[model samples]
Target: MKLEPHYLKYLAETQDKDYILLDLMANYGNDVWNFAYFLTRSSDAADDLSQDVFLSVYDRIYSFRGECTMKSWILTITRNKSLNYLKKQLIRKILPVKTVPHGGTVQSAESQLFDRMETKRIWSAVIQLPRKFREVVILDAHYGLTDKEIAELLNISQGTVKSRLHRARTKITVILETDNEGE
Candidate 1:
């Protein structure tokens, strides 16, 4: 089996744990973090979840049979881990959890506030959607993953991805419009 060149740089299924980890971080760290953040909408949770994902990946590496691309598999693990994290959060249910932004800004100050508010509004609307719809919206709309790629990452059919995306978009539109009516 010809190894994917991208995977070759970071993983070979024959390397030591450290090398595997280094490769995973070097190649997919941001993606894992982004995936986690989009799902949890909590940067801190995303950081923790990203680490958990890699740990799980290391523990489960041997089980990977190359049934899918390495990234897809890693993302699948991240998705599962995020879901688990969400479940744990629900159980641990405590005081309000706040997601603080770290730093940096590219837009002008005036536009930044509006942009942030708009982004927050959209995110709030997205969060209100069902989990399946939310995931599809983030993966396809925010992360720019293709429907086929999302299907593979989500372990769902492409048609399902398409349908969910459509439903999500419709719900989001209605949500934003309803909010506008109030304002």
Candidate 2:
């Protein structure tokens, strides 16, 4: 699934960098988008953040030391960008900003509404986790990365990834259970 190192170097050095970038987008766009969405929890923000990740990759990929897979490198960019986006959002909330009016989301089927509500509740629970736990949970549950891979990506031990995942799941269960009891 991973391309060779020489090919990654070519992408960094080639004159046809735009073409190479487009090809990279075709391969990794979904992963970038999903990672952004998982972190930001906003489709619009995720779209912008995903584009920013590609832009950052295009500009700085030559600096990639090949310490990890290209996917991890780009995803690290995404994670950083999403965190930056969240910080900006927090600042905006702290300081009132002139906001533009946007249309609301369209309604779907009743079943879809129920599913969306459930998903929203779960995500809210997930978002409440400590940053370490949330990151491991998202990388594992959303991206299907192995604990070993996550440990490498996170620069932590595999045991840490496993334990954090367990804690995150347990926390989410308690949160949802408490919510259900309240309802």
Candidate 3:
């Protein structure tokens, strides 16, 4: 796979730690926060996790080896941080909190309402999935990561990523179908 142009720039500018950190945050801050929010389903946790991920990146920037795209590497850190945050919450036996989805201004009211409802329904099904399935689904569908990138990010085989994505989609289909039947 080809490396991101910014990744090459990032590699070349590692000496200017502030510039690298700022550039990384400017480029990937949204991706990191969104991934964290999707994983934890909490804006507050996402915020905290985003901060932690960036700080970790800031501290460990030198350790980057270019084995993957810089975005993939950053997202890998995000995934790891999110999982750890969830684990700690689990260990504490604290219930996870839900976050409100953001709204858009451009669409007509009815169109926006229907769009929100559909998006909520689909995400509800996705949220109910097992973590492994959820991870692959969010990585593949939300982030549009290639199977190879996801496999590398999650440290799974490419076939496993494909399998999990298939199963996730199938489970989501079943869930939506059941919901429709009820309606």
Best candidate, TM-score-wise?
Answer: 3
Residues 36-155 of candidate 1: C-alpha lDDT, one tens digit per residue: 876776778889988898998888866767766677788888899888888888632222222323356577888777766777788778777778998998777666677887898888
Candidate 3: residue 113 Cα off by (Å): 2.3
lDDT comparing candidate 1 with the true structure: 0.77
- What would the TM-scores of all predictions be? 0.75, 0.71, 0.86
User: Candidates 1 and 3: which is better by lDDT?
Assistant: 3
Clashes of 1: 0
Backbone clashes (count) for model 3: 0
Report lDDT (CA) for all predictions. 0.77, 0.76, 0.85
lDDT of 3: 0.85
Model 3, poorest ten-residue lDDT window? 91-100
Candidate order by lDDT, decreasing, is 3, 1, 2
Candidate 3 structure quality by residue, lDDT tens digits, 1-183: 646666567668657878888989998999899888878878788899999999999998878777788889999999999999988886322233333356556888898777778887888888888889988998887778899999999999999999999999999999999999999
TM-score of 1: 0.75
- Show where candidate 2 strays beyond 4 Å: 1-14, 88-120
Local error of candidate 3 at 31, Å? 1.2
Using lDDT as the measure, the top candidate is 3
In candidate 1, which residue pairs clash? none
Task: Summarize candidate 2's per-residue lDDT along 13-75 as a digit string, tens digits.
Answer: 787768767877888898899777766667788799989999988897667777677777788
